[model samples]
Each structure stands twice: as C-alpha cells, then as structure tokens.
Target chain A: MFDEHENGYFTEETSAEVVAARNAKAEDERLRDCVNILVKHIHAAIKEMEPSQEEWFKTIMFLTETGHTCDDWRQEFILLSDIMGVSMLVDAINNRKPSGASESTVLGPFHVAEAPELPMGSNICLDGKGEPMLVRGRILDTDGTPVADAKIDVWQANDEGFYDVQQKGIQPDFNLRGVFRTGPDGTYSFRAVKPKFYPIPDDGPVGKLLRSLGRHPYRPAHFHYILEADGFESLTTHIFDPDDPYINSDAVFGVKESLMAKFDLIEDRAAQQEAGFDEAFYLVEHDFVLAKG
Target chain B: MFDEHENGYFTEETSAEVVAARNAKAEDERLRDCVNILVKHIHAAIKEMEPSQEEWFKTIMFLTETGHTCDDWRQEFILLSDIMGVSMLVDAINNRKPSGASESTVLGPFHVAEAPELPMGSNICLDGKGEPMLVRGRILDTDGTPVADAKIDVWQANDEGFYDVQQKGIQPDFNLRGVFRTGPDGTYSFRAVKPKFYPIPDDGPVGKLLRSLGRHPYRPAHFHYILEADGFESLTTHIFDPDDPYINSDAVFGVKESLMAKFDLIEDRAAQQEAGFDEAFYLVEHDFVLAKG
Candidate 1:
C-alpha cells in the first residue's frame, strides 16, 4: 500500500531500505534530480542535529513567517539570503572573472530599468544641492585601449543622503541619475554634486530584521555604475570615496580596495574656470577595464 | 580613516580558525568544532539562495514570530522542525542500532517528563472512557533473550482522541499515562483503553505555518513507549495500529513497516469475567527488542 504513491512520499518507491528516501519525485527528470540531491543532503544535515519535538515545530513556524512577511516591495527571503551570504556565493560561482578583471558586487535594490539619456558632460544632479563635482573616466579594454561608445549607467544619492526612490515627492524625478555614452576617444565626463551616504530602507520588515540581528542599516557614499559595450565584458562596479566613514564596513560587504578613489579638492582658480565651477571643486578620475568575453 | 574604530560599531574579536590552531583551547573542542562546522554549512546554504530584499526581511520576521508563538503547551518551532523531518534525522544519527533491534522514532510533543507509576497488570485507564483493552509485551535482547526489570514509559490518547496534556483541567493527572516495570521474566502486562487518532495543536504558530504551506496536521492513533535497561541500549518505539485512518499519513513521517501492530477484538464472557470487565474486550500483544550496548 505504501509503495503505491511513493512518487509523492519518497524519492524511491521501494521500502527495501529501512530509511525512507527523503524527497518527492518530480515529473521533470532534471528538476527531480536536483531536488533529490538537495533533499538528501538537507535531511542528512538535520539527522546530525537531533533537535527535540519543540525544536522541530519552531523551525516550521520560522519558515511560515518568512512567507507571510513577504510583499511586492520587501523580500525577506532575499535579505535572509544576502545576510547569510548565499547571494554572494551564487554570484561568485556564476561570475568567475580572471584576476585583474573587476569583480561584480550586488546589483542592490535601487536599480530601475531605465534612466534618462544626457549629454557627455551634462549635470546629472538636477537637485543642485551639494558641492559641485566633476567625474571623468575612460572605458578601456583588457589591452588598455579605449572602448568608444561605451554606455555608462550611473545613479547616486543626493546631498541630503536619499535616493529619488526613497524620497519620491521630495526629490526631482531623476535627481542625480543619468546614462551617458562615451565620446569617440573612450572618454566619458559627467557633472554631479557629491554623493552622500544613506541608509537602506528601514521602516519595514527589513528594519525589524536588522534590529533583531544587531546590525546597522547604513551604506557608505558610493557611485553605482554598469558599463557595457560590444566585444568587452560588462563591468558592474562601485567607486567608494575614501572619506566615507562606512567604506571599510559596508553593510552589504561591497567595498573593494580597487574601487576606492580619492576626490581631490581643487582650490586653483584656473582649474575651477576650466571645469566651469566657481566654488571649490572635487575631481574624481578612474579608468574601468573590461574583461574580454 | 575607514579603518578607525567608531563609537557604535562592533567587530569580531577572534577568528575560530585561528583559535582552533592554538593549543590553549578547551578540552571539549570537538563539540565546538562540530557547532562551527554546522553554522558554516547552514550559512552557506542560505547564501546560495540569494533571496530578494523583501524575502530577506521576511525571514527575520518569521524567526521572531516563531519565538513569540511558543508557550507552555505549544512549541511551534519544534512542530516546524518535526514537519521538516529534522527531528527524525537527529534521532537516526544519534540512535545507530544493529538490525533486529527495536528502531527509534520521534518522541511526539505529548510526552511529559513525569508519569504516574503503575504495578504489573494494573490498568492505566483512570477515566475509563475508551474501549476495554489488555496490552502485553516482552522486552527482549537483539538475540531474543528477555530483558528483566526494564522500565517502560507508556502513554496513549483516550477513545474520544484527547491526551492528558490537551485536557489538563478536565482529565485527571496522568490519566492513561503510566511507568511500568517488567516482571522477573522480562514480561509486562497492563490493561488500558484503546488509543485513538488525534490532531496536533492548530492554534499556534505551527498551525499557521501548516496552513501557509498547504499541509495537514494529523497523527495516527498509536501507543508510545520508551524502554530502558541497565546493560542494554535504550529503545524508544511506537506501536501504531494498522487500522487507524491516519496510519498511511502520519504527519511527522514516523510510521515504519515493522512498527505496525494488530489489535484483536474479543467478546469472550469467561475471559471478561476473569478480568472483571464488561462483555466485550480487546487484546493486543507486542514484543520489543533492545540492542546490545
């Protein structure tokens, strides 16, 4: 009688073995194979940790609450994966670039599908709220040759330290956001106010989660970029300001030594006039190398 | 500047890998090592599933709710773990008996630390609310020699399907729960009411968990037993009635082919008179085998 529906009960139909095979057999053989392997190892781990009846019940409740706490805006499972470092592991395994090539960090929660296209040197910071800054960078290939026509998608926080998404009504529609195409010489220049440090959303379940785990919600000031072009690998990198207090202790473990660049404070009037800024200016320059696909 | 310590930030003082390499560690480093390995693997598993931000936050919330759902009568985490099959996994790993020995199973949530002691052949049915039953069994070594003076902790639900724990106010203390000692020949006999099927508690977080996962909460009718002796391995086993409706689908995945037993109904008037019972009776005989230490 037990063998009749073993497909739904155990991985195998036969009870020849004293122990039950711990997973259900899926109709698709490949999915079944994956699930079987996962279930077997999971059961083996559980067997090793002989928790009492009360302990078992508590685990069930935890998983249930994980589902209930989910919504369109908040993803507790993703946060659970991130803090537990699962997301990084999977990302690392999938994106194994050779040494000297830039490493990929988390895409983060603020990325939108589209951004407004702007001129090569137009001010992306429409809010006009921070010390004027000029960012200049060259997109290069593995051999250090310039990659013309590279697309640089960039976004950062405003002077008050909030993304447009977080302060929808308070901030302008595209505050401190733009997509710029590199000039014929592989040079891309942009104007924006200095980015400021901000906290990840904290009023929802993630906030309660951070509080319970005794972790803070702050992220250091950094510029987000996704540079893509033909024949070169797309590079997703962040430029962390050396002065940001949370640079070494980014909550998402995103900061890298190669990603840090100093924003040199320019006091010379000649340099300021050339850059078209009257006040003291901060200048940042870094070249991004794309790995060959 | 990023490396300097801040007032509110915290950091790990010592790394376990370094401590494990030193000779000054505690004598019970094995347990510590085991726990470290477990935590590493568990965390690794979580990282692999890069859940979204909302999902991550929900997981923490779920864990908090699991703790809040616990009370003196119900432990949702334990029930959760049980359904996840972790409890049985722990039991299997801890109890590695040779063939022919009584196999161990989950100790269900209904077990109390203490039960009333009863003499040989005494009836455990204080409420007299179940079908008349006589239970007799022999405790044996793996090679078939009887084990003398073994203590058997036994309990079962009443015919209407309620445990003493479920009805603390109405049912007498330790009703249908007894601690019986084997006679000189490793023989034990007791009269009791037949056990009945019952639902696990559904009002707590575990219930909410089951509802979310689309799982039913039920267990088959059965007798619970824990047999212990001086020089032999302890045995925790259940004698599940094959006729119960839930026999095929015990919620904890606890039913084994060898653990099922038959209960025969007897209408013999002479035997009923000798036992001082009504005209109808039920007889059940079971044998338990303990593994050699």
Candidate 2:
C-alpha cells in the first residue's frame, strides 16, 4: 500500500498531505481528523513563514523553556496559548450561544478547585486594601426563566493586582474568592474589593514573546465566575469593569462586549449604609443568561 | 490607540487579526512578520479543528509532556517536529540548490561535534559485527569539477540499528563514525558494517502521537554524511540503501530519491581479498555534489 512512489519521502509541496495521509488508519476517527487539520495548518504556517533552521530551533527552544517553567503552581504552555489568543479562539468556537446568552472566555490557569462557600452578600475581601464594592447578579436561562438553585463561583485579584494564590503568605487564605448559591429567585449578591488589572506571569518564555511582539501582558480588571445550574449549560466567564484601561487591550484576548459591567459609585450615605458600607462604595449589577443543555 | 473600540475585544471572527494587531508597534520587523504569520495560521488551525476544551487541554498536556521529556541528551519536541516532517521541510526550504546538486535532508538530533579523522580506506567498524561493507564516494561541485581536499564526516548505526552513542559501554567508541578527507582526485573511501533500519525513540509523547496516528516509527537504513570544503556550501545529508523495506516510509520523512544508493553484494573471493575482507562483502558507490558558496 505504501509503494505508490519509488521513494515517497517528504517534500515541501506535499508535506502536510503526506503527514495527514499517514493517519489514514487511525483507530479513533476524532484523532485522525484532529491530526489532519493540525498537520495541514502547521504546514501552511511553515510555508508562509519559511522559517530557517535557526528560527525553527529557536521555536523548539522556546517551547522547551515554556514547558520547563510549568509546575504545580505555573502552567506556561496555557499562558502561551492564551497570549497567542488560541485559548479565546477555541472557547469562542466551542461556545456559540444564543444572542442573549452570556459569552464565555478563557478559563485561566488560576482557578482553585475548592473555594470557600459564603452566604449571600458576604464580603470576600479579607485584606481591606481596596475600595469596597457590591456585585449583584441574576442567573437566568436564555428563555428569560430564572435558573433556581444555581451556584456562582467567583474569584478575582485584589486592588494591588495580585491574587490570593499568587501572594500566598501575604494574603489571607481564599481572599477575594467565594462561592454563592442563588435562591429560588435566581438572584445572588456579594461584597468584595474592586478587582484590579494584573499582568500574567511575564518572566518566562511567553513573556519574552509578548515583549518581542510589542504587546503587554496585562489582562483587564475583572472578576471571574463559573455559574452552573441543572438543565443549563455551565458558563465560565469574566465580568470586566468598563473603567479598566486594558479593557480594549486584554493581553489574553479574553474581553467580550457582553461581559463588560458598569460600576456605579454610590456617594449617598443612605445608599452606602443600605449596602452595608460605612463610606462611598461601588456597585455592579449584571445578569448572566445560560443556554439550555 | 487601544481605545478605538468600545468593546474592542477578541472574537472568533477577529481572533487572528486582533492578535496580529497587537504587534503593530513591534520594534523588530522580523519578529513582527514571524508573529503575524504564526498568529494567523494558529487561528486558522483552531477554526478548522474547532477543538473542544478537552481536546485543547489534551494538546497542552501533550506539549508539556514533550517538553518535559527533553534533557541534556534527549529532545522530544525535535522528535515531534521530525516525525511530523517539519524538520525535513525546513531543510528543503533552506537548502534550495541548483539542478543536479545533492539534496539535503534532516541533520537529525544525533550528530556529534568531533568525529575521529581517519585516512582513506580506513575501517570504521571496530566491533567486527554484521556484513562488511565499503563506501566509496567522490565530492564534486555542481559544475562537475572535483572538490579537492573535501572533508566527509560520516556516521551510521550498526546492523542492530543502534549508534555507538546509544550503547556506549557495549559498543566501541566511535564504532561507526569517522571523518575522511578527499585526495587531489576528490575521492574518499571507508570500510564499515552495513547500516540497518531503526525506530526512533518511541517511549515519549511523540511516540504516543505516532501510535495514535497509526504510523510506524522506523526509518530506512542510511549512512549520515556532512560534506564540506573551501568555497563550497556544506552539505548534511543521508544515503539510503534502496533495498530497505522502509525506504518509502521513513519515520522522519528523511528519504529522497536523489539520495538513494544501491548496495551491490560482492561474492567474488578475489575482490573480497583485495578489499581486505575475509568473506563476502557489500559495496556502495555514491558521489556527493556540493553547491558553491
């Protein structure tokens, strides 16, 4: 079967085709398709770039260093994918939701498996270093029906732009992280410090690539949420503050128009006191709509 | 400049454009072009594959594992590039020579810096295993003129398909490796054992990928050669024996019709005696042509 050519070796013109043809008898159909498309695009890129041997070696070294930088606390390859906007692209391709449904974004490498569960309106900020803020949101289906008994997992960086996990000893455990359950009304609220824009780890190969490309490593100031309910597709998304300077230039290309929230400052003492803040505070009200499974 | 869009965030339709736009101000023109093309093709692949989150994560894990497998002696990422035919493609792109010139293949990951220089007709096989073979080659320029004093650095695996470096203590040092200089006639000759086909390292991520793709890991029996001389472009290539079963399906895609050589078995006792062989032997007569610098 392989004797079609006297010396059927690789060539630039048929490189991708040859590689893809080798997968003709793949055991898994999905694997075959995945490898075929991957090889095709890789060869396309190579033809477009015509990278020299040195350039190719440089890429291999960059990948090796990126992998070496990853451990239990760091995932450099994910950061590479995120910085290249591949993560966001994949997410967008997979999550084609209804018009009114909330858009999804990249699930960054920072989510902890078990965050502390708190009651509604409980403060998540333990350091008290940032402006107090109140966030209220309702979980609803695309049909406008409330999603009862939904769970909202929220986490964010402090005003100093550092997550609790990033500054382990300095920040309180589970700082700016909490899980809240929605009532039968599908409403959930929580109080926490305003999130801050922060740079992704820039000391590794991905950072070097960002610098070389004249791009910043800062993601926009935002809060992360993982909302799940029965009979609805789980939504992993971010709520960006409109005031953030990086909103239009998120390093990871994770910003979405539907996910931006307007933060309103409450100067009136009555409103602040009603919100349980002793002074002026900010409030963000946004609704999340999930698609039915 | 980043404030052009109210929500100028990334979307599926504009992922690659958004990523490439970030490099608009790159100081290095080469880096800009490289990143631009890379980002464009990466997004193209993602769109074509539409990989699910699990599939995407699986790719990340595979890359990380490929990276982790690299150390001082091993480079699995290079192996990945090799088996996918990227290495040979890059070589072909970089080494475009005139008609009738010797074509180049992958240098592979096994060449050492220093090979023992031997006089012409010296035997490179120290272990005295397998069938004895003699290789006679002349180095010539593209214009057909002999390249005098040309250096031919040659290396190959034993009949068992293992290089001396792969089995250090078991095999004599530099058992199948030697550097020979051409005389005024631009001709060189050396004695060694016949080469054999071998599988690339298959215990790592690249091997797993090959298995999943239903591709074998075997490369045809070949002798590696790097020919160099004054005023000529150095050539790194291989001479594959046409009789090998895997000639048309080299695992690394390193085979080329122009590089194949026929191994003639010499059963005549007088010829064997003249060639310093006690029994029957094989002979390979191939000439290499180097392009002018």
Candidate 3:
C-alpha cells in the first residue's frame, strides 16, 4: 500500500519515510511503532551529524567490538548505555514516583539471584579490609507507615573496589552481599566495611569510548539495594557515600541526592564495643521509603 | 574542564548535557564534535521513545546479536545500516555533486578488489545461463566532454541470483565481473547476462530484523560499478533495471531514479549475430558523468 513513489527509489529528503513505509504490513503493532520511532530518530541523527563514510564505518566497528566484548559475565553494550546515561534515563522514565518515595536507578549488570538471607545485625564484609562501618535503616511507606518484614538485598564492592564476583577465587563467594528482613519496628542494621569508589570494568570498547570522550570510568562508592515488600513496589537503587571523591561525578551516573548517606566516624571504643565491634568504627543511618505497588 | 557540574551527577533533565560536557577535555576536536552530536541525538531519541526497562534490554540484545553475527566475510551491522537506509543517507550527505553528475550509492558488501581487466566489447558472462545483454556506455565529464581511458569496474549476480564469489565452484571464478577502460571516444561496451534480483545475505540478525519489519531482503536487479580516472572523483554506484519488482523497494535502499536504466529486448538476429550472440538478446545503453576532483 506504500506505492507512493512511482519510481520507488530512495532520496535523501525522504529516506526515513521510505524506510518506515515498508513496515505497512508488519503484523505486530508494537514492533511497527518501535521500528518507526527508531528509524525516524536514526535518520534525524544522521542528518544532524552528516557522518562521512569512514565515520559511519567507525560506528559499525565500535558496535561490533562492543558486541564481541560480551560474554556470560560481561555486557559491553550495557556499559555503553550506562556511560551514555541511557540506562538512567530509561530508569527515570519507567519509574516516576510520588514525592517522598525513594527514586530508583539502574539495576546494573552485577546483581545475582538468590543472595544469602541474613539476620538484621549480620556483617556482610567477609574480607575485613576497609574501615568498619555500621548501617542502620528503616523501611517505611510513603505516608510514614512501617513496612515490617521488607526484604532488603544489598551488595557492594570491597576496599579494593572489586565485587566478590569479579575476584572469584580471592574473595569469599558472598563477600559484601547480604539480604536482611526488616524487624517489627521496620528497622534493619548491618555491619560492613565502608564502600569505596571503584572503576567500572574498563578493558572493553565502552571504556575506550569513555576515554576518547575525556571521561572517567570511576563510579562513586555506593551500596546496591533491591528492596521488596508485599504491597510495595520493588526498588532497585544505590546508597552513595557522601565522602567519596567521585560522589558528584559517578561514571555511571548512579548517584542521587536522596540516595546519599553520610558516614560519621565514631572514636568511642566503648560505643564500638557496645555495637559488637572490637575497635572504633563509623555509623551511617538512612531510612528508605517505598511506594505502594 | 568539564567540572561545570558542581555535583557532577546525572539527572534526567541534564543527561545529554552531562555526557556532552565530558567531551570538553577531548584532545581531538573532531572527535569531540562528533561525540557531542551523537550524545545529543541519542539522548533526544531516548527521551522521545521513553523506552521501558525491558525494551531497553531488548535493544541491547539486538545490538549484541547484530555484532555477533559479523565475521571476516560478513558485517551484520553494516547490513543493519544498509537496510535501515543509514548507509545511503551518509553516502548522499558526503557525495553531494552538481545536478547533472552521477549520484553515488552504497558499495554493498559483495565487491572484491582486483577484478580481471578486459578490453572493450568483451563478454563477462562466463557461465552464460540467462538472456545475453550488451551494455554500451560513454564516460563523460559533467560538461559532456569525453573522459578517455577511465577505468570502469563492473560486477553483478548471475541468473540464479548468486555472485561468482558466493558460488565459487558452481560459477566460474570472476564470472559476470570485469574491469574495462574507455577508448579515445570515451566509449566502452561489454556483454553479460541480465542480472536477476538477489537476496542479501539474510540468514543473520539483519535478515531477522527485516522479516520483523515486513521488509523483504531482495535488492533490485542491478549492476555494480566503481569508475575512476586520474583527476576525477571516483563514483561507486549501481545501474538498476526499471522493470524489476523490487526496483522501488531495494532492500538496501540503494536505488536512485537517475540510476535506473531500461533493458530493451531485441529480437533482431542480425544484430545479435553481429554482436556475436547466438540467440535473441537484450541491450542497455547509458552514460555516466563524473565531477572534477
């Protein structure tokens, strides 16, 4: 039905329309809409950039290398999306919440299913490398009602800024990862080493792109959380350490003002002993609010 | 210095800006400009689409598959660009010539270097399975002056829609492919079977995408050419048959109205005998104009 062109040839002026018109017979409406939007935007971008043939080939090569860099463990395309701020943009678009509820961020490629469940006061730092810290938090609904029994799954990098999965044999299987259930008072406390700033896996094409753009690949120190409760929406987010150098310039743009938690150092050995620490440590307190599903 | 972001955090509203700001420190100005433009367009597309998290992941998966489908003999990403019309768009943007000059199109993935050189009036149809055709063309400058000794390289698929390179044993080496030079009058002629419409190498991700978009993988029957001379810009393009069903819907979007040539069936046995053909044949005549370098 798209026989508008008597000669049916391509011209620069109608390139996108010609391509989109070919989809008139597409059986899937979603596919048609998606393809149309994609073609339109791609054409717009090409017109804006006016890329030369060589530059176009360079893009193809970069995308090919990005695909080749992926394996069962690594996803360079995701890294590309993250560094481009696309992941966060998609997350933001998908998760528009009412005020007072915690905002969500990217569920980075590092999360694993079935993390070990632990008591509220359990320590997740099996490495014992960085300065000890205590994190205590409450789970509440948007209107201030307690969300007891909420499952809080957390994970983070160690002092060396390496995840347990990254240093498979060196770090314990579940190093710096745990799942805790909020108590009846909606309170949950965990002891662990302070999170440290870390560079993303930068040995791939995405890393090369970041470097070429004069951008760093370092993300601020942060703890990952996937909080879920019976009637509340599950939240995948990060809690950033306010003192980290990259706090303002996270490589993946995972930091938010509401997600930042202050880490206060405590010099009192007595207080540390009372909290079951053998030496002085730091304290971080922040509450999380979830919206109804 | 991209330290304009006192907070250096990515917000949905400032996502593209934050990414573009990083390029302020790029050493290569061209790279900086290209990257800035790319980031702006990509962010604009994302905001316009507002793709869901699942849809975002689907895109990543598609790109990864497109990359993985490429190897030494094939480039699926290029095919993606070709079918999407991006390759032709780039070519048009880069090769804008004056109104009477020959327009360029995509140099498809099938061209090979070092085709056998032949004198004018040579027959390139080694296998000879289809109706024989004579192609006589003159090479001229945009001013209509002769451009003698211009090298004309041409190749096309056989009657079964397969290139010699694609079917090494079935067809003779370099069948339907040759290079010729214009004589003092800037006239060259060669004999070859009429080219048939051919499907692109569509057993990969690109093919799957085309199927999903309700687009066929068949390009119009056409002859590929790359003409060059000492002081003129080389032209890479195609001469498509006007009667081909896919002429208006070339899978690669490579067809241009000015490039379409009519193939006239000639029933004159006398002319066929004079041209050394043993049966009824076809004739195609066209002229090519090149711009001065």
Candidate 4:
C-alpha cells in the first residue's frame, strides 16, 4: 500500500561556488571565460528588467520572426539594427573623430564587394538612365594637401530611385556603379544619374519591426562610399544630398553633419554645349579630406 | 564624360583616438552601453577570425533567418541558443549548485500562461484520452520540514505525446494541464496519461535554425513544473523519465542530472484494486527537495 502523506524531508543542495569550482575542469578557457561573462551580463539585465513571462516570450518570438525574415537579399537583423540606429551608433563609436575632422557615417547595407574599375574621367553612368549628373570631388588631408590615388568606390540609386540590388534582373548588372581612383591632384570625377530617395525594404519582418517601433523605413537620397588608401584609415561612409526630404531623418540613421556634401548647380551652358548635353543644370563639385593615419 | 582608372590612391587617415573622440555623441546612453559592448566583443571575435565578406554575410544571413523564424509557437532564437548550448550553459551558470536540490533546466517555448487550478488528486486528463497514469510528489525543505501550500503548475503532452498548443483545435483546451496546491502534509497528486516522446515543432524558423546548425529538435518526454513558496527559491525544472530515448540529449539541452526521476512499476493487485484501476502495472514516484530562498 502506498502512503500518500509524508512530511519533513529535505536535501542539502550544493552551492554554486562549488559547481563553479568543479567546472574549472573545462578544457576551453577562452570559451568558458567568454560564455561566463556573456551569461552574467545577460542575466544581470534580465534580473534588472524582471519582465513577465509573456514579455519574455514576446522577445523570443520577435527574435524568431527576425530569423524567418532572412534571405540572401534581405537581412532583417541588420535592418533591425539599422532602424534602431544601433548599427550607426556602433560605427560612430568605433570611428570617433578628432576636432575639425570629417565625421564618419554609417556604412549602409548595400555595398557590393567588387566594382568595375573606371578611369578618373570615364563616365560611370552605364545606363545613362538618370538626369545627367557629374560628381566631382577632391581628396585632401587635414592640412588640405591633395591625397593622390585614393580608391573611391561609389554606388547609388538611379533617378527612378532604385539600387541595382533592389531590381536585380531589371537593371544592368552594374548600372550607375563604378570604382574610380583619384588623380595626382587628389581629384576624382564621375558621371551618373541623380539618386532619389527610396524606402528601405518593407515587405518582410523588418517592416513589422518598424511598425512595432513606430517609425518609418525610408532612407534619404545619398551616395555610398568606401574610401581606402595606403597609410590612411579606411572610411566607410555615405554622402547624403541635402535636398532629400528625409535627409534630416534617414531611417538607417546614416546621415552625419560632416558627411553631407554640397551638390552645386553647374550653370555653364557653354560647357554643356561642349559636352553635347542638354542645358539642364546638374550636381557638381564636392571634396573629402583624409587625415594621416 | 567619365574617366576610367585602375588603382592609384594612397593616404593616411586620422588617428584611432581622434576618430573615437568625435563619435562619442550617442543618442541613448543605455543603448550605447549595450551596443558598444556587444560590438567590441563581436568585432574582436571577427578580427581574430578574419572571416571574409562572404563568410560574414552568411553569418548575418543566418541571424536574419533566425529572426524571421520566430513566432508564438516556435522560437528560433532560443533554438539557436540551445543548439549553441548557450541556454543550458547560462542556466548552469545562473542556477549554480545545490547538491541534492533539483537542477534547473531550459525554460522551453511551449509553456502557456495561466494554467487552470486543480485540487490535489484531481485528474488533469481533460480529454478523457491517453493511457491511464498518475503522478504524485511531496514538498520538503533542505532541513526536512513539510512545506505546506506550495504551488505547483504542471503540464505535459498526452499519451499520443501532443500538447494542446501543438494540436490546437484537436486538443480540448487545457488538456493534460493543471496547477495544484500542496496539502497540509506537503503532498500533491494528479492523474493523466503517460507522456510520449514527440518531436519539437519543426515547421517554423526553429526548424530551419536546427537544420542549419546540424541539431535535432526533440525534447524528451517529461513533465514541466514551476514550484514556489514564500520562503523557498522558486524551482523551474522538469522531471525526465529514465525510459525516454532523449533522456540524455534533449534537443534543447534541458535535461539535468538531478532532475531525472525513475518511474517505478506499481503492479501490486491490492494497490490497483484500492485505486479502482486495471491489473496492468504502471509508474509512480515522488521527489522530495529542500527549498532555499
């Protein structure tokens, strides 16, 4: 016969310190240290928040949905960080600026690794699709010395406002994208259509994330850049056009006070005539300074 | 007109400290702290590994997919942490040690909030289905004293080994689930069908995460518990039956050494007769434990 009622019985459990001592036998010291710290920090945060079980589940579910939204073309986690401004914040923290130095901005998610090499003066406008625009810039150091042979990789949305990645099959493989090396005088120039503002991808979980966070998912009109050279710290930044409506509030938080470049109107009708183009004024000169590493 | 040039740029950028200084204006201090620390560790790992762009993208893509796969029923991020053994490692670190005390385990995603209350000895087999079974246990402190009126929330799959959340409409609401209060003698009992081993939900992003990580998604047949009292540290653990195939390697790494309870055969005809049960032998057991707050 089984007796159902039994009282007074307890087990003296071991202490956490004892278990920790026992676990000191683990072979991977680095991994153990890393995991222990990570665990401690995460647990500290959890204890501080004391979130309800429902809230905890919601967080887990949010993460799960983020994973489901990922693919080769879309990275929702990055987008999540982008919208939250965490990516730009991290970039800013890592790339601090000295006084009077050009500020670094976020490296937007759309940079392609390899761009076709183009000569300084060769027009990079493969599609000739947007309003005929010329981007001329000088690369200078802090003291204004021309830094020659600086590698400049640039890409932007066409006038219709679409990056190649956004419309892969529809656009030329490298439409409006090119890599140019600065000339001896620290000068670089290129011809491409004016880029228009476009909304970040909103068809996936990121859209939901944006909605949940009460924010829009639109980036301002800007040109992406990767500037690198020997003896200089590489800069991954974006040059936002001041004219874009969202210039002051890019969804990805990529705009920076120093990264904004003046796009001047080229009013030389004679020059337009000489170039065999329409009399339409277009974007012209801007320059960047690179400090000695 | 655009010029084409190959490679030619060279320049030295600003010092790291200068860059770090200007980027210090973080919008939110709390967010900045979290992100900066995360970036430091993650980037350090990246620097150490020196993974190429493609490899980095793959990891990003993996994270993105993990987010997309999360939902109410399945949590891919938890699955990710589980496969990485991070969850169990964290639990192990946090739960520390209590030699004879029940070991903590992974808090799985299937737990639903607000289980219905049941009187001690009330059958929780709502659907009137599943193999006949009974579970009973006593509450005791480390120093051997009856802990009266302890709350116990218990849930598990049916004999067919499916939770109500898994079957949705097919399962009667709250089937095989109940919350009980220990009697004055520190004992609680319930009747239900024996839990059958079943696969974790594999249709969501958790499945994709598991597949990608080369991990199986299966939890051993066990009963979930959340026991608490005014003076004792709350216990969130599972009782794993020795007979389950997954007793050793729960997909979520939730099984603990101290939490394993043997299901003893009860074939005494007199006991069966007293309980108004069939002649077939079944399992029975109780776990006594000390409570430390």
iRMS values for every prediction = 8.6, 2.6, 2.7, 12.8
Docking class of 2: medium
DockQ leader? 2
Q: What is the per-residue lDDT of model 2 for residues B1-293, given as tens digits with 9 covering 90 to 100?
A: 44334335687888888887777878999879988898898788889888989999999999989989999889998999998788888898999988888999989877877989999999999898999999997898988888899989999999899999999999999999999999889989999998998999999999988888778789989999999899988999999988888887788889888999989999999999999998999999999999999
lDDT of 3: 0.87
| Per-candidate total of colliding backbone pairs | 40, 0, 1, 53
The CA lDDT at A92 in model 2 is 91
Q: Where does the lowest 10-residue lDDT sum fall in candidate 4 chain A? A: A3-12
Clashing pairs in 2: none
Tens digits of lDDT, candidate 4, A128-247: 776777788788887888888899999888877787877889888888788988878888888776677888888887676555444456777788878877777787777877777776
| lDDT of every model, 2 decimals | 0.69, 0.88, 0.87, 0.65
Identify the leading candidate in terms of TM-score. 3
Model 4 CA deviation exceeding 4 Å by range: A1-75, A80-154, A157-189, A192-293, B1-30, B89-100, B126-131, B208-214, B288-292
Worst 10 residues of 1 chain A by lDDT: A10-19
DockQ of every predicted complex? 0.12, 0.63, 0.61, 0.12
Q: Could you estimate the TM-score for every candidate?
A: 0.64, 0.96, 0.97, 0.61
True contacts kept of each: 0.09, 0.76, 0.66, 0.12
Candidate 3: pairs in clash = A248-B8
Per-candidate chain B TM? 0.85, 0.96, 0.96, 0.82
lDDT (10s digit) by residue, model 4, range B142-183: 876778989888888887878888889999889988988887
Instruction: For candidate 2, write residues A1-293 as lDDT tens digits.
Output: 44323334577888888777767778999989988887888888888899989999999999999989988788899999998889888889888987788889878877887998899999999999999999997899988888889999999999899988899999999999999999989999999988888999999999988888778889889999999988888899999987888888898888888888999988999999999999989999999999988
Give candidate 2's TM-score: 0.96
lDDT of 3 by residue, A1-293 (tens): 33324435567899888888887778887888887777888888889878889989999999989988988788899998888778888898888878899988888877878789998889999988999989997999999988988999999889999999999999999999999998778998999998888888999988888788777888888889999999989999988887777776777777788888888988898889877798878899989999999
